[model samples]
Target: MKKLHVVAAIIKKDDKILATQRGYGEFKGLWEFPGGKIEKGESKKEALIREIKEELNADIKIDKFALDLEWQYPNFYLYMSCYECSLESDLKLLEHMNGKWLGKDELDSVQWIEADIKVVNYLKENL
Candidate 1:
């Protein structure tokens, strides 16, 4: 199976965290943290910054490394790094299915992609 390294941002503001829905691919309609695959020549933070700009038209400062996980999907192995981030500008979604600001208590309202469950658990415990 192909292996992919990616970064995801947990943008927390006040009582809510940002979650994005997939607009395409097998995971369409599933919610995920805002981020994408790490491109060649890009560091994890760099890839996350670039992806946020492309997907949300917003900027963020990576506050800290949150967690990392490895998961095997049907066709690939996913190595994902998660970060706690602070948004620096207004968020405007230019890509993907949908987005929402979910409170810690409301995290389970939407269906999350398989890989994001652990991150969500961490958030619930700490936030």
Candidate 2:
């Protein structure tokens, strides 16, 4: 099985978590944290910074590894790392169709990708 390693940002401000809606691909319109696949020779942190810049057009300071989850989908096995991140500005949705800062109680309001829904549930229980 091919391994897909992705870094996701858990950007929290005023107790709300930032979530993006995918604009294209297999998961288009589904909500997920802003991040992307690790490219060759890039460190996880480097991939994260690059991804956030590419996807959200905002600079982020990664604090720590918050969670790691294995997701088995019909097409791929995904290994995702969630990191606590602080954003420097309001995010611009460069690739996503929409974005929102959702409070814990409103997490279920948006339809999330299956893999990402696990992360949301985890956050609800722990954060």
Please tell me which predicted candidate would have the highest TM-score against the true structure.
Answer: 1
Error of 1 at 107 (Å): 0.5
Clashing pairs in 2: none
For candidate 2, the 10 contiguous residues with the lowest summed lDDT are: 84-93
lDDT of 2 by residue, 1-127 (tens): 7779999999988789998999999999899998999999999899999999999889999977888999998888999989988998767889999999999999999999998988898889967
Q: TM-score for all predictions?
A: 0.97, 0.95
Q: Which regions of candidate 2 fall more than 4 Å away from where they truly are?
A: none
Residue 63: error of model 1 in Å?
Answer: 0.6
Colliding residue pairs in candidate 1 = none
